[model samples]
Target chain A: MKHIIVYIEPKDASSLKRTSYEALTAARSIAGDAQITAFAVHGSEQALATAGNYGVQSVVVAKHDLLSTYSSTATAEALAQYAQSVSADTIILSGNASGKEISPRLSVKLKAGILPDCITLENDGGTVKAIRPVYAGKAHIAVQSISDHSIIALRPNVFTAKQEGSANASISSFTPNLEAKHAGVKVTSLVKNEGRLDVAEADIIVSGGRGMKGPEHFPIIEQLASTLNAAVGASRAVVDAGWRPHGEQVGQTGKTVSPSLYVACGISGAVQHLAGMSSSKFILAINKDKDAPIFKVADYGIVGDVFEVLPVLDAKLKAMLHS
Target chain B: MNILVCISQVPDTTAKIQVSGDGKSIEKTGIKFILNPYDEFAIEEGLRLRERFGGTVIALTVGSETSKEILRTALAMGVDKAGIVKTDDILDSYNVAENIAGYAKSISPDLVIFGRQSIDFDSSGMAPMVAEMLDLPSISVVSSWNIENNVITAERDIEGGKEVLTCSIPCVISAQKGLNDPRYPKLPDIMKAKSKPIEEIASCHGSALVSLTSMVLPSSKRVGMIVGDSEAEIASVVTALHEQAKVI
Candidate 1:
């Protein structure tokens, strides 16, 4: 039987990101009757308890003072040691920024194959086949692991998180022996974007493009986003024009987001922009031009001035939600 | 102060991608290939660093002969030298990283830079893996960078905001978009780049950890109906969203 391990990251000491649960769901689907271990560095009891709800047989928590803060190299070393201890054949992680950073280190350390940003996976007998987008979503490639051990980073929101009856999983602690060289890189400070959800994690995103004209016009998009409890995203053009920060840009060059609902306002859908968000479950395009490329992929199109449409929609949504 | 920039050639973002008949790979016909856009930032950063630090900047790529075009673009951007790890095999990220790390060991550059991820594979693994192999510090998705007295300070985008990090020299950094504006190559520079020699080396045929089983296009979305552009349609759109689609 194949041994699978899902890497979990706690958002804080008390809670975990939703994507970790999604990774758990993916692990369970591929584990079949094999053993599943939820692994984390500096993971708390609360996070392990949550992992237990996903039907994992056991949880491995690696504790180190250096791990209290995020150190990609140190964490990878710890996780690799833990994986070796358990002889995990397959490792799964969320394809978020942290996972993207750490997976490579682990892959090199273990000399294992890695598939990043996978959308789907299936176990064909003993070998696991996975599908992932390539060429920035222009096409998909299905790959199978040829090595004895492999790593898979699942794209968030693609796998549905299903809760199984609690397994009351036993927790094991692992302390890795890391040297001073492993702590070469340090996070000096983090400037948090207060009161705003990151576009990558938000369920709904209201985005603007060059059609918003200038930085001054972004507040309307923000208003709509706040009304809908959504995050605000910008197209590459606006970001290049210095109207928005790069972190907020959504495109092939920026963050790939797959929210439940995506509203593109004042955006003439460039192929690069669509490549990032076309996988959204529901897309709504609001632009004055009827022939905007966004409308081609949008589930619903509203050809109107965003200035006029946005306020009306915002008011309507506010009322609907309040009532 | 030597710097090495790693780049990848990818289909132009606007290129039409078609699946091959065998369902194994993308059809290459009629597609315009260009340097991965994010790599442009890496090249630009390398040039800027060389200008400030007085050292050679080398551009390297691992791919087939077609990837030489990518090296020329880097040379045109003022990279002092270019190299290609020539291979046509579809290698996985681990193999690619091992090859890059192997080359890096021979060069022993002070700084190694890469695009945050290649647009083709979207695997943001190579730079860190190389750093690990070389036992150097590395940071990814850096938007701003400064070096003072051999110490590198970088600001990178995290989930909500940015994180400021500090590391010593002989490090790896992956460039993100908006780090800096890449320059357009002048005609003279483009001509010079065409004449510059690109050193080609045979790639290490490491065993691929992952093998392609098949490839397929994403299932297309259903054809959506267009509602009229009237204020009256707002209510109907909301009703359709709430009742028909139920996404909100």
Candidate 2:
């Protein structure tokens, strides 16, 4: 039987990230009746309890005083030890910042096959096959591992989280044999972007492009996003032009978001920008240019000035939501 | 202090990408190649670090001879030297990391830097894997950094915030976009870069852990309808989004 492990990270001090549950769902699809374990470092009890509802048979937490904060070396060392202890044939993780930092180190420690940013995965008669985007989402490539063990990082928002009854998963704790090297790196402080939701996790995103004019004009975009309870995103042109923070960028070189609703304001669509948000369920484009490429993919397009259209749309939304 | 920058050559961001007839690779005809934009930040950071601390910055790449073009771009951006780990085969992330780690071990630089992720593969795996192989601390997606004495303090973005990390020298850092604005190469510097000799080393070969089976373009998006430009018409569109699309 194949043994699978999903790495779960805390969304905060108390809860697990939604992407972790999505990783669990991916793990379940791979491990039919076989063993599936949820692994976390300094994981809270609530996080473990939630993993139990997602079909995991066991949960492993690596606890240590030094792990109160994230250290890439320490986390990778702990995860590698746990994988070896369980003889895990496959390991899955969310393709978040932490996962991107740790999975490569863990893969090296275990000498396993590694695939990051996978959008689709299937168990092909015990050998796992995955489909991932390449060339900045311009194309998709199918890949399979040739190693004894495989490490996979699933992109966030792609996999749907599903719970299958109560698994009653057993919990266990282990102390990793960390060395002095693991302590070489330390996180001193964490400053949250306060009040702003991450674009990758938001259900709806209202993104601005170069047509927004300057950094000062972003407040209007922010106002609209706040009205819809959505995150703010910017095209690469604006981000590179220093009109927006890089974290807010959505395009080939920035965050790829697959939200339920993506509203583009004053954005002349580039293929690179479309690659990032084309997966949205509903795209709404508002631009003065009638022939902008964004209109082609938008569920609804408006050829009007963003300054004029945005206020009307914002007002209409406020009226509809009664807020 | 010595610094090493890793870079990749990729098709221009706006290039029209087409899948090859064999369905295994991209058609390279008439494609304009440029140094990966993210790597530009790395090259710029390397140059800035060398300026602050007396050191040499060496730019490296693991690819075919054509990849030397990227190294030349780095040289034009003020990197002291350039090297190419020449390989003709399609190496996986593991092999790529292994080869880069081998070269890094030989030079033993004070710091190794890379772009957060290559726009082509979007792997974002190499820098950390190289660090693991070298048994050094690593920070990926770093937006800002400072070095006091030998300790490096770096800030990187997380889910909804930023984290401040500290590590000593001989660490690996991947440059995020907001780190700095990359400098444009002057005509004189571009000409000078052409004369610099690139040190080409043969790459170590190993069986790739993951192999590509096939490649295809993403499914096409739906052709949408254009609503009118008037306020009344725009209101109708928003109403349709709420009632008909049920997305609002």
Candidate 3:
């Protein structure tokens, strides 16, 4: 890649999201001698400056009144316009909700190809090839851009955000001429799940399944999660039975998580559920059935009933983590 | 309100997948194909909208001849019409979006809907890409949707929580898992759907922008250490997580 543009999404009005930093680190890794430019819309000076810590040489803050509120069309228009002005050949963004929503539009605007939710990217003799999980992590496919310009969305929590340089990124502003029609999709409001960790972004997760028997028994799973400071997860069956929210469902139709540690409680490890979390760094499966498929992928397996095993596990972890 | 619902056929989630001999695609033999799970919600939403507002619900898919099965499923689910852009080649998302957008333009539907993502590719790019191509506003992963007076208010999942968005007609939506429970086709409807005409459209074969290089199964590197249900075994797991895995 010659000139790379890394799209930055603000966590709030002032700071960049953790995934944005990881995008910068990813761009730096594949950039080689290429110039890396960080792009954002209506971000604070403090937020733009932090890109330097992630090895960005310069930053471009695109500005417009309509752009202040996140609109897929308007943001994509600004990114496309700026990329064209700078003659950038590649655009890298995080594969979070906003990024996933905008990257495809940006790709179409720039007449480029997109590699979405990519886990690994390699520069192969002047070509960038990426490996992304398909079929919900059951299989992976190596892909490359056949178009002149390419857009890559990196999967969250996969790439490490590292500070390779100690220089501040030079900041510039670009004001794209946008019309009212461009602000077609408007975010009226956001309802934050305060204090609850999302499984998609959590480092550790304790998940329940059909083996939990009933929704009333979930506190056993939650206590263990609380003791570990991890997020709570559930199997599709549990979520379907109204025992958990859809957001906490971990499986083919739900969130795909690759946390540092995953604890499966009462989950039987259906192929669909396994497809979502088989990539965790460490897995601990607890079940009464000794032959449950979850043990095949778990690093540690404790064969016992959840009712009997969870309290002890929670107490043990509480003692270990606290002491 | 003319609604257009797009869908895809994917291998059953429970079906085992193997990399084909070409090393670039999955082995399809002995695999049972099913309607993409998320698309069920898309089709259901389309049917519900048609029931509320007077409109024709059309289902479309850009895939090979085998994809017509999903169109039949949509027909059984009460779609007014169905069509397929037939092609055998493995088109990338760009071309797929191009064809779907092409059909949407020809029909000029007031609303376009799709599943959040296809289970096979799992890219989640269709609705937005097609929306951009048609130059219309779009919302994705919508869990709750309300429409009145050509205005759409939707609640969708974001990273940490829910986001409420509003847009006018001539918009696009992608359904999330919790949108609605799709209805299964009855025996009579399934029989009636078999006779429904599936209009075959010519594939708009554009040069693919992205190409698959290879495909492989993910290798497991887990250290499978099994323990009994004893209190000591439970304690040992905590110790292993603390010292050995060091994740604590």
Give candidate 2 regions above 4 Å deviation: A166-169, A214-219, A240-243, B221-223, B230-236, B239-245
Better of 1 and 3 by TM-score: 3
The DockQ assigned to candidate 2 is: 0.73
Query: Any runs in candidate 3 off by more than 4 Å, and if so which?
Result: none
- Off-target runs (Cα >4 Å) in candidate 1 are A166-169
Residue A273 alpha-carbon offset, candidate 2, angstroms: 2.2
lDDT of 2 by residue, A5-99 (tens): 88997776656788998999888887776688888886667667678788776888898866767788898898888889878888899988889
- Cα lDDT tens digits, model 1, A230-256, are 999999999888898777889888888
Candidate 3: lDDT of A226? Answer: 88
TM-score order of candidates, best first? 3, 1, 2
Model 3 agreement with the true structure over B4-50: per-residue lDDT tens digits: 99999999998888999999999999999999999999999999988
Compare the candidates by DockQ and give the number of the best one.
Answer: 3
TM-score of 2: 0.94
Tell me the lDDT of model 1 at A261. Answer: 87
Better of 1 and 3 by lDDT: 3
Deviation (Å) of A201 in candidate 1: 1.6
